[model samples]
Target: MGKTYLYLLIAVAFEVFGTSCLQASQQLTRLWPSLGIVVGFGGAFFFFMQVLKELPLGITYALWSGLGIILVSISGWVVFGQKLDLAALLGIALIIAGIAVINLFSISSPH
Candidate 1:
């Protein structure tokens, strides 16, 4: 993978971690956990900003935000016993496909 993709991955990984931590942080009861989430999110956003240098804002942001939401939701289902029905799963799949299409086929990307 290219540097841009690597950076994007880093951002995603950190963001997922942060989001998971946020869940652990319940109503300020888990202050330390919440602090960790803030730190993780800050780092992820920093890497995301770096990735933006090599890709179009619309394309990069679309994939980043879309994939991140799906991953976070999936994580919630798996880790927290949250309900994920067929529709949500299919929607996540569609989002992934959309990101793939944007990255692999669309000439709309500035890169």
Candidate 2:
């Protein structure tokens, strides 16, 4: 179960990295950043598959996508000078809370 969460975290990390690279890819015109997209997304899905082996798809995808959204938003701000207004910040906080609720209360979560 612990290992499953680890895999999920790794998957999220790779997904965040891939999305960052995607931004850097400049519409797929670059070479190295494009490669980073491939490797990062590939690694993300691989680890995600490992996670699915132990956890339900709904729970896994919720955490994966929720955290990915939050992290990618942060990356966009930090790496790309993007800004998040008040509503966006509120939405992100809500997403974090939702993931916490799922992990803390969901029966489908791995023990």
Top-TM-score candidate index? 2
Clashing pairs in model 1, backbone N/Cα/C closer than 3 A: none
RMSD of each: 1.6, 0.7
lDDT of 2 by residue, 2-43 (tens): 888899999999999999999999999999999999999999
Model 1: residue 105 alpha-carbon error in angstroms: 1.3
Ten-residue region with minimum lDDT total, candidate 1: 102-111
For all candidates in order, the CA lDDT equals 0.86, 0.95
How well does each candidate superpose onto the true structure, as a TM-score? 0.90, 0.97
Error of 1 at 17 (Å): 1.3
Candidate 2 achieves a global lDDT of: 0.95
Model 1 RMSD in Å is: 1.6
Clash count for each candidate, listed in order shown: 0, 0
**Model 1 per-residue lDDT tens digits across residues 6-62:** 899889888988988889898658988788798879989999999888887888889
Off by over 4 Å in 1: none
